[model samples]
Target: MSSRISGPGLGSRSARRAAAVTPLLLAVLLSGCSSGGSGGTKASSAPSPRTESTATATAPASPDAAAYRRWGIDKPLAAPPAPPSAKLTDGLKPGAAPKVIRRVPTSDKVVFLTFDDGAEKDPEFVKMTKDLKLPFTMFLTDDIARAGTGYGYFEQLRGEGNRNSINNHTLSHPNLRTLSADAQRREICGQQDVLEKRYGGKPPLFRPPYGNYNDATLAAAGGCGVKALLLWEATMQINDMRYAQGDQLRPGDIVLAHFRGPSELKGTTMTKMVANMLRSIERQGFTVARLEDYV
Candidate 1:
């Protein structure tokens, strides 16, 4: 949850973007959220289905990336493997220039899962992601930690495999636009230092709280070395998911969720919420892929 902590083991998860902006854009714009559930959200749009060579994963022919083969995927991705990333661009490098991105531009039927706020630290959610071998990303806020350091669960996530990327949400979940420029820097750059110290690398990505940002926000983010200001195309709740453009899933969407537990979700656990999300993804014939690999 990125909003206020309502109670122990409970926090408010917000996909509550700028109420002034449209949730779904007729075209792929720099829009930020879909709808928030107890889970995640993504951003982007397409008039029709797009093709992605990177959408499929067969038995990994290489030893380095072999973990892709063990995915406990529900059905065949039913697509061919993408060619090697010869000359593939790496959009995740620090200081790459900050641009608002609703979704990755690709033809591959791969989507990203990004959970914001470090609120509900659920051990079972960690196990579920490991068991499924699903690759996703995390946009974390420091103040929302559940226990000592509030980072143990994420450390646990990192230890399990090489499938996820950690990003900066902020020190506290505040609308950067509401604060002064230096305060904004403290919010953006301050967390950059904290996350780097804790996670061992500076976060190259960032997502403003409530999908709220302005020109000053982006400027502060870029000054603090953020490469991309991420938004979403879909949002996930406890029981189901929401879309930006239409009811159908489009290629290259980045789904958003929160690290929440039973307290915030009408007594539903994070595992159940994730299960519903996976069902939605499978129903759409899309596969979960490493967000960093294709960016």
Candidate 2:
């Protein structure tokens, strides 16, 4: 319009138009900014992409990953299969001498770890068992286990739920094969009493010292309420395992290890030795199973 408009009405209309356009302009600006404007100065509360990726990459995949690393294991140990419902005793009979077994009779790719004598009670080993939820059997000798704080040490290993078992080794670590019938009975039965009184309930399993046994030893064990005489298919030493027949582990093999420390293991801790043993088992694709669950 060529004509000039000068009045309060014209001023009011211009103000209204400006007021309406102001909101539209502001809304357009906000929409552009929210659409990832290059000049936007807004800071985000969310983590950056690189930070998120790094976090995911560094996170452990398993709850036991740290534990496996701490124990020098490359990977977490495979879990054993569910225990048999009826619990196979490997043809154990009642009212007779308990059957001696070097290995459990099963087709599963599992092996049993058993510790003997209870000579060295390393606190770390107890922690390891709890950390790994490891299952093993202990054959304790009265004289050795009861010695100077040894019983208390083993009591720590015997945690709740009875995940592990304590069986009779002997009153004294003696060659039952060399002892007389009465003497064998005394040794076997004496420890039975001690274990029953100390741990509660008679043990269903027994292992003669040095794996040396005779008819007299079996008879004594049976008389003392022992249901099975456990021997081993392999003996785990500080650095390696000694198999009875072959160089490899067989399914259901009972692996014998000791409650030993640096003194007995040539400066290797019991936990470290166990870690190495577990590595060997892992390498062979075998898993650890509870001996009590089977026998």
Return the top candidate by lDDT. 2
Clashes of each: 18, 0
Residue 285 of model 1 has an lDDT of 77
Q: Write the per-residue lDDT of candidate 1 for residues 170-203, one digit (tens) a residue.
A: 8877867679988888999988888777766577
Residue 251 in candidate 1, Cα distance off native in Å: 0.1
Distance (Å) between predicted and true CA of 2, model 2?
A: 99
The residue-by-residue lDDT of candidate 2 on 75-121, one tens digit each, is 87787877554433333445466655667767899999888777676
Computed on alpha carbons, the lDDT of every model, listed in order, comes to 0.60, 0.65
Runs in model 2 deviating more than 4 A are: 1-63, 90-94
